[model samples]
Target: MNGKKFVESHFHKYLTEHLNAEIALNTIQNFDIAMNWIRSTFFYVRAVRNPSSKYELQPRMDKDLIDRKIEEMCLRQIKELQKNGLVILNGMNLQTTVYGKLMSKYYLSFETMKLFRQIKGSETYLETINTIVKCKEFSDFVIRANEKGILNQLNGSPIRFPIRGRIRSNEDKISCLIQAVFGNLTLPTPALIQESIKIIRIGDRLSKCLLEYLRLRQSNDSKFRCYKALLNALTIVKCFHAKLWENSEFASKQIRKIGAVHSSLLVNAGKTTIKSISETDARTIESILNLSAPFGNELLLNIMITYPTYLLDISLKSENVIQVHLKQLNEEYIYIGSHTVLIVGDSLNNLLLYEENV
Candidate 1:
């Protein structure tokens, strides 16, 4: 079938299933309810899809009937929002609630918003990642015929989280791919690597959305679960950027000039990843990577110097500012963010840490 017919048939089947289930049409009480409402769009879809003269649609609706249908659809959706606590219908005007605002800020779909609303902000880090994969954004990722083998291969290799049973649905693919990214598992092909990276970038954004949601949840209840979820969200956010788990010895592989082999070798020899290279002598790391005498020092210096030397100001008569302010000890840089950093300018400048705040 053509694209239009295919979409029509898809919706027809969807509506039929909803009808067979005897699902209510008034309010979307949860994610499943919201999804059903989303899928049950046959009536309006047909009305809109049949404008072409070639198509013969159902009996034409008069102006009054069309307006009534429009009103009914709008009211049904509004009721769904009310049921989900996303909006408040006071008299005539419908006002958005905090949940609604949060959903709007993230540009989340109604279905996704419902799912987010249900989360209590107490899930484990792995659970949080799994929850994020359920977003509507990942629904379109088609798992190839042979991709499941690769996913299972990644799971068996060294992923932070592994799945059991058959890998079903795109959500599973996303979750597996994310774990593969964190573990730095060698994807079979570059295409697969690129695909995983794209998913990672999108997943990173959704993870941020969940982080904010958890933070809000914590503020309201102040429960241990809420605080834990917030903390997990924070860690998950950083992991997404670093592309490695916090405990992964090979997390340093994300740095420039560092690879899985380099990290593995260094980690095995009892050296540092990226964080505490300062504690280890440069010569030790150098010898492990098998570089000549001074190159190890140079490698160490290059990597350490770029670890968040803030661009306070870059000065010039051309009105450029300059002053490298070392902010509080954190992986994030004031200018070039992320643990993996490259100081573009001042290749000649040396980085020194001050014991006291400057």
Candidate 2:
């Protein structure tokens, strides 16, 4: 028989026989209700698979999507339960409520049966189950058992299947299971190894701060200290050139270009010419000139020693005698104010430096 037909037949027979029988062991009335709900759910899913529907446009049929659908159905059931005053929402999602949980368990059992059959012949089934068990998350044992049963059945229902020996302790059992499954798996490639190492290094640094904060109970003072520490670390790391700047050609070119401009301008200005002005006045004028220039020329060095970068604008504005108009390359006024300086074609860093000097 075709795969789809086989699956449909098995699903129908299983629902009518095994599932109904299990439900009947509970209250007969609830058995009927649950059976009807399960049947309806199966039909709804089958209908969704029809190419004529909009639901078919959705992505793949994964476990997460199935879980979500089951949750939605459970929520509807829970709402009915709540209306009858048998249950409460309690600010929880469907999966967290009593009625919702019952429905989820039933749905999970059915879904696991389907998945077991689907994965039966796959070479990775045992490996996949081993990984799930090792993770030890919710429903791991149930999933593994179902897979094992299906695999055993597929292998001709052998009277004496090979029994893997269990270890004496739980920790040993988990370790042995992992080793048995993955010991033969090949090591990662060099590129993957390098990436993993980088991730581990970053994680380790973050983990140290995390542990310290956790141990201190993250009090207000502790939090503030952590924040300050992070800022200081960022400053130190940002200043480090070993990993990024590292004698780069770009850095060398920028230094050479700026140094050449500084030498040419300082040479033309002549040492004797600057000697007449008082040192302080010379420094102040140089700062003002840097604020007015497009580049961090000799003017910037003088400004750095004479005036703080923040006071530049205030000092310039106080000079009411000079009306400064900042203009663009086309001589169009971009800004007009007292002591405003026009800088043409300045890089963002150079502009920032000028702003600081001002």
The CA lDDT of each predicted structure is 0.62, 0.31
Q: What TM-scores do the predictions have?
A: 0.67, 0.17
Best by TM-score: 1
Worst 10 residues of 1 by lDDT: 348-357
What digit string (tens of lDDT, one per residue) describes model 2 on residues 113-199? 222222211223233333222322222212233233333332232211223442333322333222221221122345323433343
The pairs that clash in candidate 1 are 313-321, 313-322, 314-320, 314-321, 314-322, 315-320, 315-321, 315-322
Off by over 4 Å in 2: 1-224, 236-358
Clash count (model 2, backbone only)? 2
Cα deviation in Å at residue 134, candidate 2? 24
Candidate 1 structure quality by residue, lDDT tens digits, 40-87? 566555545452222223356554555454455555656676688766
